[model samples]
Target: MEQLARLEDLPTRYVADLTQKNLVPLWPSLRNVLPPLKPIPHTQAISWKFKDIKPLLIEAGELTPIEKAERRVLVLANPGHGLENMRATSVIYLGMQLLLPKEWAPAHRHTPNAVRLIVEGEKAYTTVEGEKCPMSHGDLILTPSGLWHEHGHDGDEPVIWLDVLDLPLVYYMEASYVEGGECQPVTNTGTKSRYGKGLVPTQHHIRAKNNYPMLRYPWAEAKQLLNDLAEAQSQGPIQVAYVNPETGEDCQKIIGYSAVMVRANETIQMSPCSAAQVFHVIEGQLELQIGTDTFNLEKADTACAPCFAQVDLINKSSEPCFIFIADEAPIQKKLDLYSVRERN
Candidate 1:
C-alpha cells in the first residue's frame, strides 16, 4: 500500500486557511484511524505485582483516613495510555483498594459498573443494593452501575481487593458520576445461596425483580468448578464465565469476568481477539506472554494485554494456576466490533 499524503505537503497558505476555518483534510490521517488490517491499540502489556502494590496501599491507608479518602484506592494505570488516564486497558479501570479493620466506606452509587475480586484478608463485606456479600480471597462481588454499595471490615487484619470497573468508557462518554448516601439497612443476604449451578430460584419464572439477581460469586465454587472441568476434560484450558443465573448472560453489561485454571506445567495459547484483556492470578504462579513481551505473575499479580495481541499463558508452578480475567467483550459484541483472528 502507498503511504498517505502528509499534511505538510500542502501549501502553507492552504493549510493556514483550513486551520483558520476549522476545516481539515481527511487523507492525511485516514490511514491512522483506519489501519489496513487491525486497530493500533494504545493499551500495553503491563503487570502490577502485589508485593510492590501492598506497601503503597498500606501507606495510602496510613496517609488518608476513610472519612477523608472515601474509598482509598491505588490505581493500576497502564502507561501506554498515559498514567493520568487511570486505566488498565482501553475500557477497564483497575485499582487495589484497602479497607482497614473496623473501617467503613460510605454508601454511594455511580454510573460505572464495578466488581471486586477479594485479594486478601477476610471479614470484609460489600453491601450492594442492600445485600451484604462477604469477602474472601478469590471471591468476586458485583456492584453494578447505578447500585448503591459500600464496604465494611470486621476482621483484625487489613482487607484488600482488586476493583475492576468500566469507568474509562463511562467517563469517556461523559456519563460518569456518583451520588453519596447514608448507610443502607441490610435488607438481604447474598443471592448466591438462592441459585446453584444451572439452577435459579423458581420465583424467577413468575416475575423477576432485581436487575442483578446475584451479587457475589464465591471463589470456592468457582475453584471447584475449574477442578471438575479439568477432571472431565483431558485437553484444553479449564475456564468458567461468571454470568447471570437467570438470563445466562454476562454478569455485567460492559465488562465480562471469567476464571481460568491451567493444569500443572501446562501452556495455553489464547485466541487473538479485538478486545483488550486483563489477567489476574488468584492462586499459584504463571508466565504470561503477549506477543514478544512476557511477564511472570504470582498470586495477586495482575497483567493487561492490548487488543489483538497474541497471548499465551503458562503455569510456572507444579501446582495448578487459577486466574481471573476481565475483558471488554460484552461491550465490544454489543457494538459489533468483537472478532477473533485465526492463527495461520
Candidate 2:
C-alpha cells in the first residue's frame, strides 16, 4: 500500500515541477500520444458473404419503406474496428444498399465522395444532378462530394449495389457535412441516347458544374476494353482504374477505383502499398493473402487489405476471377504519402 501511494503521487509531483518551471511535460500522455510503433492497424482482412446477407436485405425491403429507412443498407463493418460504427476499413466506408422496384431513395448530398458498384438487379439507376445514370451488374456510378444524388428502380427485380465512400476519413478530418437535396427525380435516358452507345460525343456537355464531368461509367464499354486488353496480353491480370472521362483523373477526389480480372489458376504478384484498399469479388473464386493470413473469397464477397500490409491474390478456380476495388490512393496522393513497392 505504501509503494502504491508513492507511485500515485508521481503525477502530482510532476505537475508541481512543471508549474515551477513553466513547462508542461508529455511523459504521462506518451502512451496515447506517442506509441513505440503503430498501436493498431485501422483495417483488417475481412469478408462478407452475399449468401448470408441477401435474406436480411430482402427482409429489410419487405419490412421497411424507402423514406423511413432513408437508405436500406447493410454496412460492411471491419471486425478490427468499432462495431458501433460501420466501416469497411479505417479510412473507407462500405455498405450494401437495396432499392426495390418502384422505390425511390430520396435525394441527398454530403462532403465525403462516394461510388456505387452495381452488384445485382437491373433497369435501375442513380440520378446525379439532373442526369439519369442507369445501373447494371458490374457498372460503376459516381457521386462526387457535395453533389446531389438519388436512386430509383423501375425494373421488376430489386436493385442491389455496394456503396463505397471516404466518410471515415472525412469524419476523422472533421469535414463531414450532409443535407437533404431538392426532392426531384430526373428522367431515365439510359446513356445511349446521350452518348451514342458508350461512345463520348465530340461536343458533350455536363449538367453539373462539378469537378468530375462524367457521372456514369457504363460496364459495356469498360468490359469490352478489358476484353481487348486481355486478348492482346497473355500473362498477368488485366486491370483498369475508373477515371473521369473529362479529365482522365480519379473519379472522386478522395476515393479511387479499379477493376481487375485474373485468369484461372493464376496468381497475382505481391504488392505493398501505403494506401488501404477494399476489394469486392464480382465473379469466380480467389485466395486473398494479407501478410501471413489467407482467405478464400467467392462472388459477392468483400475483402480488405490494410495500408502498408503486404498482400497478394491467387485464382485457383477454373474460371476467371473479377474483382472490384476501392482505394484511398487519392487521399494519400493529395497528402504526398502514396507509395507502392513490389514484394520479392
Candidate 3:
C-alpha cells in the first residue's frame, strides 16, 4: 500500500497560510481517521487485581469520611487511553468504590448511566429512585442516568463494589453532570422478585411500565441459571444477558451486561466484535487471552479488551468460573456500528 502524504511534504508558506486561516489539510491525516481494514483502538487489554486494590480501598475508607468524599472510589484506569483519563475502554469507566460500615453516601443523580457489581462484604444497599436494592456478592445494581441514588452500609465489615459507568461517552458529549439531593424515602423494594421464569408483572398489560422495572440482579439467580444452562448444554459457552424484564432489551442504553460461566478445564474463544468489552471475575479463576496478552484473573478481578480483539477464556480450575461482562454493544447497535467478524 502507498503511504499518505505527510504534513511536512507541503510547502511551508502554504501550510502556514492554512494554519493561519484555521484550516488544515485532510490528505495528510485521512488514513488515521479512515484506517484501511480496522480501527486503531487506543484501549489495550489490561487487568486489575483485587488483591492489590483491596488494601488501598480499605485505607481510603480510613483516610476519608463519607461526608467529605461523597463516594470513595479508586478508578481502574486503562494505561492505553492514558491513566489520567480514568477510562477502562473507549466508552466504559471502571472504579472500585468503598463504603465503610454505618456510612451513608448522600443522594445524587447524574446524567451518565452506571451500575454496581458488588465485590465484597454485605448489608449494604443502594437506593435508586426510591427503590432500595441490597448489595450482595456478585450482584448487579443499576443506577441509571438521571436516577436519584445513594449508598448505605449496615453490615459490620466494609462494602465494596465495582462501578461500571458510561461516563467517558457522556463526558465527551458534554452531557455529564450531577445534581445533589436529600435522602430519599424508601418507597419500594427491589423488583427482581416480580420477574422470573420469563414472566413479568401482569400490570404491564393494563398500565404504563417503569423504564427501569428491575434495579437489582441477584448473583444467586444468575449463577443458578448458568448452572442449569451448563448442565443442559454439552458444548459452547454458557452465558446469560442481563436485560430489562419489561422491554426484554439491554438493561441500559449505552452498555450491555452479561454473565458467562466457563466449565472446569474448558476453553472458549469469544467471537471478535466491534465493541470493546470488560470482564470481571465473579467466582473461581480463569486465564484470559486478549489478543496477544494473557491475564490470570482471580475472584473480584477485572480485565478489559479493545474492539475487534481476539479473546480466549480458559478455566483451569476444578470448579466452574463465572464472569461479569460489560460491553459497548447496546450503543454500537443503536448507531448501526455493531458487528462480529466470522472466525476464519
Clashes of each: 0, 0, 0
- lDDT for each candidate structure: 0.93, 0.81, 0.93
By the TM-score metric, which is better: model 2 or model 3?
A: 3
In model 1, what is the error at residue 123, expressed in angstroms? 0.4
Candidate 3 residue-wise lDDT at 237: 92
Model 2: how far residue 137 lies from native, Å: 0.2
* TM-score of candidate 2 relative to the true fold: 0.86
Model 2 steric clash pairs: none
Per-residue lDDT of model 2, residues 211-266, tens digit only: 76667877777777777888899987799888765556787788889888888888
lDDT of 1 by residue, 1-344 (tens): 79989999999999999999999999999988899999989999999999999999999999999999999999999999999999999899999999999999999999999999999999999998789999999999999999999999999999999999999999999999999999999988684666765357675474358778878999999999999989999899899999988788999999999999999989999999998999999999999999999999999999999998999999867899999999999999999999999854
Better of 2 and 3 by lDDT: 3
Task: Looking at model 3, report the run of 10 residues with the lowest lDDT sum.
Answer: 198-207
Off by over 4 Å in 2: 1-40, 185-190, 193-209, 342-344
Question: On a 0 to 100 scale, what is the lDDT of residue 117 in model 2?
Answer: 90
